[model samples]
Target: MPHTIRVLVAKPGLDGHDRGAKIIARALRDAGMEVIYTGLQQTPSMIVEAAIQEDVDVIGLSILSGAHLTLLPHVTRLLAQERAEDILVIAGGIIPPADAQLLKEQHGIAEVFTPGSPMSEIVRYIEEHVRSAKDLELPATA
Candidate 1:
């Protein structure tokens, strides 16, 4: 059997809001992907550790505390340090376009979903971009 795509949805910093994160996690689950949500006030290290533990294919960060510029890069850096940079990173919630660009260009975030983005779009993006572990393996030889 093929491996399922696993995702880690995190809320970093002091962001008390998690309705959007919960919604995205539910949507991903509905789309047949396994989602691990790292509830409120998670640190960068905590997020990366959870991703490693969960063996996630993607890390979806939701930051409404206007700390995307700081927290996003921190998570990316921690992932790099853990050599888990291969995991795709995506962000959402209250991020401005300029910061989104920085996230993509500087921090290597795969995508950013601002408010008003359709849940279908987020689901589709993950389906299209994240490669499952089974997909990366070579077939057995005869």
Candidate 2:
């Protein structure tokens, strides 16, 4: 059996919309990946906590309220602080080119997708980018 990639789909900050996040969650699930969706208005801390607790390999953040700069970076920073920076972080929705580049270059975001980006592309990216959970060396449990 193939290993399923575990992904946490989140909408951080005051983004009151969730259609895109839902679509992505469905896409990831359809691709045979385990997906957890954190509904609207989640804080960065909430997102990171869920990611760690769930032991997901990736975090997909969908932001539409124009707070990508603050929210995305804050998420990465929190993950770093929690020693969870190994989790791959990606973002989607309404991010500008410059800001997206900055988020990728400086904020530890793995990728950013905008409107009109195909769901297949999103699926393919996650499929290609996320390492299978089995590939990771887990600490020995007592």
Which has the greatest TM-score? Answer: 1
lDDT tens readout by residue for model 2, 1-142: 4456899999998888999899889987877778999898999999999999999989999999999999999999999999998899999999999999999998999999998999888887776676452364332212
TM-score of each: 0.91, 0.91
Q: Which residue pairs of candidate 2 clash?
A: none
RMSD of every prediction: 4.6, 5.3
Clashing pairs in 1: none
Query: What is the Cα root-mean-square deviation between model 2 and the actual structure?
Result: 5.3
Poorly placed runs, candidate 2 (over 4 Å): 132-142
The lDDT for every candidate, in the order shown, is 0.88, 0.88
Per-candidate clashes, comma-separated = 0, 0
Question: Weakest 10 consecutive residues, lDDT, candidate 2?
Answer: 133-142
Off by over 4 Å in 1: 132-142
